[model samples]
Target: MVIKEITYGGLSREHLFDRLKGYPIFLNEFAEMLLFSPHFCPSPQQQSLSVAEITVGGLGLQQGGTLEEIRKQARLLGLVECPLEAAFYSRFYFTDQEEVSKKVVNQNPPGALVIYSKPLLADRNFPRGLYLRKIKGDLWLRGYRCSDDYVWSPLDAFLFQVNASSRTLE
Candidate 1:
């Protein structure tokens, strides 16, 4: 389900501009996640945290689990589509587009959905990470960050170069 909130660069109004009661600062990022994976759900923690679980990939990455755990699971599962960068995107939820990936232009032709860990750079109106892409006839992306990092890895920086189309939006 798409989040019913106005957003720019993935940040919704409730997160960047309006501070609603009983909602965590990262809620907006989690809301956008629903747009990517149909099997995922957001579990808010007392308006302080937005945690999720990965159930569709046959992976046991659970809610409240640290970002490293998700990375480890992806590695163990050897999901080719779930690249090492999925972890980086999840860990650094709010890095700039330039910080998203070095090459940036990923599978934009097919349209990709980037998911994020947490809302990093919440103060800068930045976007979160771990957008989704389909390969092997399935959607895959991973990460769960509690804090945002500005440091962009090679694949992550390329996220900026991606030209997302409406295809992935489905």
Candidate 2:
């Protein structure tokens, strides 16, 4: 099942942009930061930071759960074509191309739907990670103040690079 999730990139938007010094920042770089340092993804606090579980849906593939419901949700989001195993890992979501063309012209979040129909390599033991082909014309990009904090690891960085490069390749 396709699911909607929010990923952490280990550094805030502001910190990242400050480090970039105005250089174009890509998702891969975020992944690298996660993997580069072991402390990047610290274990969840023993006590509950909040009662809410981070898992959006019960489709916990990592914890031996099913993804049928998650995929159904993605379908509800209008993703007609998607990988069969996409639910086993992670997937990115964005608007379609035509929508992107119309809405992405501005610097705000692109209206296109971009799905990274694959999982992260670090989460599982597979190489080549997941593939995020531009299934639609929507660019699926976002801009924000450089002061956001998104933590990541080196492995995360590698995955980010792989994902970003794959898009560029296509």
Q: Which candidate wins on lDDT?
A: 1
lDDT of 1 by residue, 1-170 (tens): 12111122233333422332222222235334433333332222212122232232223533323334434443454321222223323323432212123233322213333442334333333333445433333333432232322322312212221112213222
lDDT digits (tens) for residues 1-170 of candidate 2: 22333332444434543443333323333334333334333222221110111121221223221233333333443333222122111223222223323333212222212222333333322321222222243221221211112221111101111222122223
**Whole-model lDDT, model 1:** 0.31
Global Cα RMSD, each model: 17.5, 16.6
Per-model TM-score, in order, reads 0.22, 0.21
**Candidate 2: what lDDT?**
0.26
Off by over 4 Å in 2: 1-27, 42-89, 92-108, 112-145, 148-170
lDDT of each: 0.31, 0.26
TM-score of 2: 0.21
Q: How close is candidate 1 to the true structure, as a TM-score?
A: 0.22
